[model samples]
Structure formats: C-alpha cells, structure tokens
Target: MTTLPASAFLGGFALTFSLIVSLGAQNLFLLRQGLRREHVGAVVAFCILADILLMAAGVAGIGRLLQAVPGLAAWLTLGGAAFLAWYGYGAAQRAWRGGAGAAAARAAGTPLAATLLQAAAITLLNPHVYLDTVLLVGVAGSALAAEARPLFLAGAGSASLIWFAGLGYGARLLAPLFARPGAWRVLDGAVAAVMLLLAIGLLASLRGSLGIGQQP
Candidate 1:
C-alpha cells in the first residue's frame, strides 16, 4: 500500500472546483432547475457522474485519442456553440417574458426523462468540458504517482459532488425571492448572458482553429 500525497489531493480538488464553479451553461441550467424545484437530484447526479467518467477516461489515456483527432474537437466546439446559442436565445426570451405565469407554469415542468436527457446533453455535448475536465485534468492526474492518482481523482470527484449538491439544494433558499416574476426574468437574463458569452468563446476558438479570419 502507498500513502497518498496531500498536495496532490488538494491540488485536484482546487483545480476541479475552480473549473466548474464558474457561470457556464451547465451551471446556469442547474441553477434554473434548482430554482424551479424540478428534478434537481437527477440533474446534479448526472453532472457529477459525467465529470467522474470524463475525468477517468482522460486519465486512462482517452486524452491522447482526443488530441489525435483535432477535427473531433472542432466539431464538438461548433455543436456546443450552436446549442449554447439556442439555449441563450430561449433564456433571453424567457427573461423578457417570464412573469408570474412562468413561475406558476414551473410546477408543470418538463418530463423527468426529458430533463435528464437534456441535462446529459448539456454536460456531454460541451467541448470545453472535454478540454478542461478530461484532457487537462486527466493530464494533471497522470502527473501524480499511480497510487496518488486515485486520491487525486477522489478529490476532483468530491468537488463535483459537493458543488452540484450545494448549488442544487442551496438554491431553494431563494425560493421566496424567486416568487417574484421580476426575479425570474433577472435570473434568466443572467443565464442568457453567460451562455451567450460561452457560445461566442467556443465559436471564436473554432474559427481560430480553422483559420477563419479575424472574427475574434
């Protein structure tokens, strides 16, 4: 048996937390689900599971495969960008129009299966996730001794589990505030801005990779 390095554990936790704590499409959607009191468990579970699987795959040398096929990354980037753009447009529309009616309608939320499917799509389809969680984080894990890799991965996985659980459950605290239609609009608008910005970033990266003029 080998002792795990404390530094490796902490480093993995910090890196994973920082990468995921930001306001991205996945977070935005999670927040919305959390606020709406929908299938937050499923949402959070799917996200954490996705992170673990991706990270594991990356550490297991999937990153090498991804790096070899640059075109795959390009396609994922474009697809994810388009998805983000669509979601952003929808969120913007909701921001502009959501009111008491929207809040009330929340009770009749989307089907659980559909929600889970969409959640899966958002988590899996995003190209940045592969880059950040799988390839980058995986490389970091690989740096540690094989014995320490498990600890590093545990630390990384812990961040995902803790963060998603907190975000989803803690969101209910704002239920009172979200009671106001104006609040929903504000939240939706914020989500829209974040999603749109991310989409633009992905699109720019794709363009740059493809040598598409000075678009950025």
Candidate 2:
C-alpha cells in the first residue's frame, strides 16, 4: 500500500483545484441553483461526492482503460466540445433575449430529486469531467511515490470539498445583485462567453488533431 507525504498532499490539492476550478456547465448550473437557494445542499453534495468517487477511481487505475483505447480521448474531446458549444450558444441566446432570470426561476421550481438528477447528468455526461478526474488525476496519482499517494488523494479530495461548498453557497451572497434584471443580463452574458470560449478551444484542439488546421 502506498502512502503520501504532507507535501504530496499539498501538491495534489493545488493540481486538482487547478483542473476542476473552471467555469464549465457544472459550475454554472451549481451557481445558478445556489443563487436561488434551491436544492443547494443536494447539488453541492452530489458534485463533491461525484468528484471524490471519480478522482478515487482515476487514481486506482480504473482510468487506465482510457489510455489503452486509442483515439478515445479524441472522441471524448469532440463530444465535450460540441456539448459546450451548444450549451454556450443557448446561454448566449437566453442572455441576449433577457430571459436568464425567468429560466433560472423555472429551474429552481423543479423538484429536488429532479434537480439532483440533472446535476448528476450534467457532470457524468460530460466527457471532459471523466477525462479530468479519472484519467488525468488518476495518472498523476499513480505517479506519486509509494509513501505519498494517500496524502495526495487526501489533498485532492479536500480541494473538491472546499471548492464545491464555496461555489454552491457563495452564490447566495450575490442574490441581491442577481435580483436586478440588468445584473442577470451581465451574469448570463459572462457565463455565455466563458462557455463559448471553452467550446471553441476544445473544437480547435480537435481540429488540430485531425490535421484539419495547421494553426488552431
């Protein structure tokens, strides 16, 4: 059995946080839910728990199957890119049409079970999340010295707990701001921009892989 050092734990925390702390669909949805104070605990718990499971699976060599299958990563990247693009476009349209608040309220009205299910679907369906947690994080964890693996995982798990809790609860602090229609437009617009940029970048990378573009 491998154990991790204190330093390894710190390193894992930083690395894991860097990868997961992005403005993706999951984060956006969680934030929206948090702002409305609807199913906030459930959403945060699901995300954090999912992260723990996925990250552990990755570090346990379960993610190695991905490395074995050729072009698997590319296919996932393609799918993720497309999903991000569509999601971003929808967000942009909502923002442009000034319907973000309405949409959010409708979503909030959804049952807790449905909201949890949606959150799970959003995270599990995203190929990028699997790649990041299982493959990338697992591979990195596997590389740790025998004495530092445990600490590393601890650090990574801790980061997930901290980030999800913060993101889910922190949105409430901005409730007053989001209450304003103009603020909704700005917030939605920002979300749209982030999603679009992520999508474009993913697609560009895929294009490069296929030799469709000399420069991405």
Candidate 3:
C-alpha cells in the first residue's frame, strides 16, 4: 500500500462536503430529529454509515453500473424523483394550508423504530443518494491514483461524519426560531424547493439520455 497523499484527502473532503452540504430529505430529517431531541445519535450514525458505504462503493468503481446501463439509472431515477416531488408537494401544502405545524408535527412523535426506518429509507431508498454518492463521487474519486483511493474515501466519510454531527447537535440553536409557525413555513418551503429542483435535474438527465440513445 502506498502512502496516502494529503492532496487526495483534501480533495475528497472538499468534494464530499460540497455534495452533502446541499439541502435534501435526509438532511431535513436529521435536522428535525435533532430538534426533537429524539435518538439523535442513532440518526447521525445511520446517515454517516450510509454515506461511508456509498462513498466507498463509489470509489471502488461499483457506481459504474450507472454508466454501464444508463437505462437502469434513468428508470430508478424516474420513480425516485416522482416520490421526491410528491414529498415536496406535501411540504408545500403544509406551508400554504397551515397543516400540522412544526411543534405539532414533532409532537406526533413517531416510534424510534419508525423514525430510524424513515431515516434509512431516505438514505438508501432515495435514488439521488446513489447518483450523487456512488455515481458522481465514485467517478470523481476514480480519477485519483489507486493507492490514494483509500485516503479519498476517508476524507469523504469524515465530511459526512462532521456535517451530520454538527447539524444534529447544533440544531437546538434553531429550535427557538423553528418554534414559530412562520419559521416552519419558511423551512418547509425551502425543503419543497430543494426537492423540486432535484426532481427537475433528474428528469433532465433522463431526457438527455433519451436524446443520446435516439441519435445515430
């Protein structure tokens, strides 16, 4: 095994953080769980573990399944994007119609099993996670030398660990603001926007693939 270069580690860290920093279902759920102060550690661990496995799989070139069969990725993306759109629409409905409200939603207090299962679903069931972590990050990391791949994986895993830790633990700072329904409205609206934007991107990718397949 060759010595891992600092550059490899840094590259992985920067790239992972850039992708994970974005707002998504997983992050939103994490934030909610944090504020609710329910099983925060389990939630954070599940996310980090998912990230690590996905990133590792990506760096190992398992994500090439996406390129090997774009059709597969496209199909999976279609279903997943549809689900995301529906989720976003629900959030939008809540924002506009004044649905359960944040505190009330929190008070609903799902069982820990249910909460953790949802967390797993958001992380593993979501097609975008596979696209971003396995396909995108994997292809990017594959650009590095073979010996440096481990360092890259380490960096990516570290970023997930750090971000989830901070987000879950630091959520209390926002608890005061999120207490207000108005604040919940803004948060839900932001979540809807992110979900819709992701859906748009996924559909666009499928369209591009179809376009390419039809040509010559």
Write the residue-wise lDDT of candidate 2 on 75-99 in tens digits: 7777766766776776677687776
Q: Model 3: clashing residue pairs?
A: none
Count clashing residue pairs per candidate: 0, 6, 0
Query: Global CA lDDT of candidate 3, please?
Result: 0.82
* Candidate 3 least-lDDT 10 residues: 97-106
lDDT of each: 0.87, 0.81, 0.82
In the range 1-216, model 1's lDDT, one tens digit per residue, is: 334577777888999998998888888899899998899998999999999999988877789998998689888888888888888897888887787666656767899998998787678779989988988899999877888888899889999999999999899999999888889889989988988998899989888888879655
User: Where does model 3 exceed 4 Å of error?
Assistant: 1-4, 97-102, 212-216
Identify the candidate with maximal lDDT: 1
Candidate 1 residue 190 C-alpha distance from true site, Å? 1.0
| Total clashes for model 2 | 6
Residues 109-195 of candidate 3 have per-residue lDDT tens digits of 778798788788667757779978998889889888898888888888899999999999999888888777778788778878887
Q: Regarding lDDT, does 1 or 3 come out ahead?
A: 1
TM-score of each: 0.93, 0.81, 0.82
